[model samples]
Target: MRQPERERPTWTFLTHHARVLLEIARNPEVRLREVASGIGITERTVQIIVNDLRAAGYLDRERVGRRNRYSLNTELRFRYPTEADVPVRRLIDMFADRR
Candidate 1:
């Protein structure tokens, strides 16, 4: 017999990179440690992801005082060729605060 669905699926739609981006999009000054806690991930992992994003031109990091600040490259399109034309701003906007 078929089994019932679990309370939560094992897979998620948004990638860690996407999650980090969205988090920063909402609050540019947010701390990476906070992002990790909010995302249920390790701070070191978040740091690695941030490095990847920066290397890929998805994010720009600036050191403001003691904490680092992030800025998204809104005009930059997705890396995947399938969605290369689609700017990441659309993705960010899709998950923007909705009330």
Candidate 2:
């Protein structure tokens, strides 16, 4: 007998970059390995995405001893016209855990 195929989503509302950013926002001290593991991506990819975000001025990194810390530039406006007026912080807050 033939088995039925399982359906899976091919897309999501947020991109991998957004997911990484949100993870960083939630824990500035989080490690790249943790982000990669949590998001199911490679550590190298996480590093690249982090570099992209830093280059775009969306994030700032500070070296502390052997570890690095991140700080989000929440005041920056969204890149798209549809949400350009909205601050990045608002978006982060939407997905951030309320405690």
Candidate 3:
């Protein structure tokens, strides 16, 4: 017999900021709409999050022709005390595709 499906939790280990950063890292040329849709958030929220990341020095945005390209600042350290010494690259590598 098949087991019952487990319920999903309301919280996650990664925050919206991390999610946005990961998405941008995955595709630097990705549009806000695509990131929003992929992350299940509003485009406006993505815009705000991108701004936050930029202001925090975790992301760099550059205009590439008609679109914007994002570059991750992997050298930056995490904000939390527990992982404060860890670089952003470590977190990104955890979720990044191996192929």
Candidate 4:
């Protein structure tokens, strides 16, 4: 008898937003295209994510001549109240320290 095929899982613990933020945290000067490739998302999507982060005051962008430099607002708290006491810094540090 043939075995039944298993379906792939569509859900993930982390959202695209968090993945984008983590990518930025990993590389302060990373390119959006690179971020998109790393996250398996489109460059346009990465751009939108960056805009969202900027508007939320979670990050700041600085024009560094021909290239753009990004700075994170680590002191900012998570949006959800469940993690209200946690600062973005802690989250960044958790992943940043891995490498």
Cα RMSD for candidates in order: 5.2, 5.4, 4.4, 5.8
TM-score attained by model 4? 0.85
On the 0 to 100 scale, the lDDT of residue 18 in model 1 is 94
Where model 1 places Cα greater than 4 Å from the true spot, the runs are: 1-7
Write down the worst ten-residue block by lDDT for model 4.
1-10
Number of clashes found in candidate 3: 0
Q: Write the per-residue lDDT of candidate 2 for residues 1-99, one digit (tens) a residue.
A: 222335435667988888899999989999999999887789999999999999999999999999999999999988899999998899799995632
Rank by TM-score, highest first.
1, 3, 2, 4
Question: Over the full model, what C-alpha lDDT does candidate 1 score relative to the true structure?
Answer: 0.88
- Against the reference, the lDDT scores of all candidates come to 0.88, 0.88, 0.88, 0.85
lDDT of 1 by residue, 5-45 (tens): 56545788999999999999989999999889887789999
Model 4's alpha-carbon lDDT is: 0.85
> For model 4, how does the per-residue alpha-carbon lDDT over 1-99 read when each residue is reduced to its tens digit?
222335434677878888888888888898999889876789999999999999999999998888778999999999999998889888787876554
TM-score of each: 0.87, 0.86, 0.87, 0.85
Kindly report which residue pairs in candidate 3 clash with one another. Answer: none
